[model samples]
Target: MSSSPFPDTDLAGNDARVGDGRNLDSILRIPVLMQVVLGSATMPVADLMKLGRGAVVPLDHRVGEPVDVMVNGRVIARGEIVIVEEDNSRFGVSLTEVVGPSAADQNT
Candidate 1:
């Protein structure tokens, strides 16, 4: 039998084999930037320059449409905006679907 060049031991120096609980535990702790995309708009230079306070620019998406969730600038999921609680004090995104790598590639 041959041994893998990459040992299965984790940073804690435990057995921590691959595909086991510990391997994923450490990885899950890594912080990542998450962005919720509302929508976008395109306008000419003249129109863009005319914008001021209280200006309302229309976007392509509707109010109830699902928004794209991006991680590291790549679209990784889709979700809808939701309130964290019934109080409506905080906002959050409720995941609708998780995007696979192939699907994410097309979006980017």
Candidate 2:
């Protein structure tokens, strides 16, 4: 019989087996890049080059529209921008919807 390298018990001494008894802790620690896309715009190179400080570029989405939350360039969820009450000067994303496996795969 072969022995597995991952510990069978979690830190609390409870069986840590995930679906089919696979330990997920180690893989959970792996980092992935996350991005919140507010919107996007397209413009001619000449117009793009004219962008300067205080210049506004119109985006496809309107205000209050849900923004896509991407992981490694794939959309995984959607959220809305919210002001962080803890720090009024900053903003945060409040997840509104979690993409299901089918939707996530389609986005990719």
Candidate 3:
């Protein structure tokens, strides 16, 4: 396989670059769902049903632990939760570990 500076396919991943003048613009325009996972917890249905408005579920991660940044369904990076200084109402992640393509490939 070789690197393609120009797009060779359509939005559906079909060969369209030759068929039409379309470039990778369509693919680039596609929306990807990115997620920052703080933590998660698992509990029995009975215990879950007992929860109320003020319910608090403890997560497996520690307070200072780095959170995973996932794209689609794969973990792409890790970062710490941060509060936006410009807007206190908004929160963001400060990336600490970025997974390169080679590094990510090795992990799998």
Better of 1 and 2 by TM-score: 2
Residue ranges of candidate 1 with Cα displaced over 4 Å: 1-27, 103-108
Q: TM-scores of the models, in the given order? A: 0.67, 0.72, 0.73
* Backbone clashes in model 2, listed as residue pairs: none
Stretch of 10 with least lDDT, candidate 1:
1-10
Q: What ordering of candidates by TM-score runs from best to worst?
A: 3, 2, 1
User: In angstroms, what RMSD does candidate 2 have relative to the true structure?
Assistant: 5.3
How close to the true structure is residue 11 of candidate 2, measured as C-alpha lDDT? 88
Score residue 33 of candidate 2 by CA lDDT.
100
Q: How do the residues 67-103 of candidate 2 rate in per-residue lDDT, one tens digit apiece?
A: 9999998788999999999999999899999986675
CA lDDT of each prediction against the hidden true structure = 0.88, 0.87, 0.87
Where does candidate 3 clash, by residue pair? Answer: none
Candidate 2 residues lying further than 4 Å off, grouped into runs, are: 1-23, 103-108
Lowest lDDT block of 10, candidate 3:
17-26
Using TM-score as the measure, the top candidate is 3
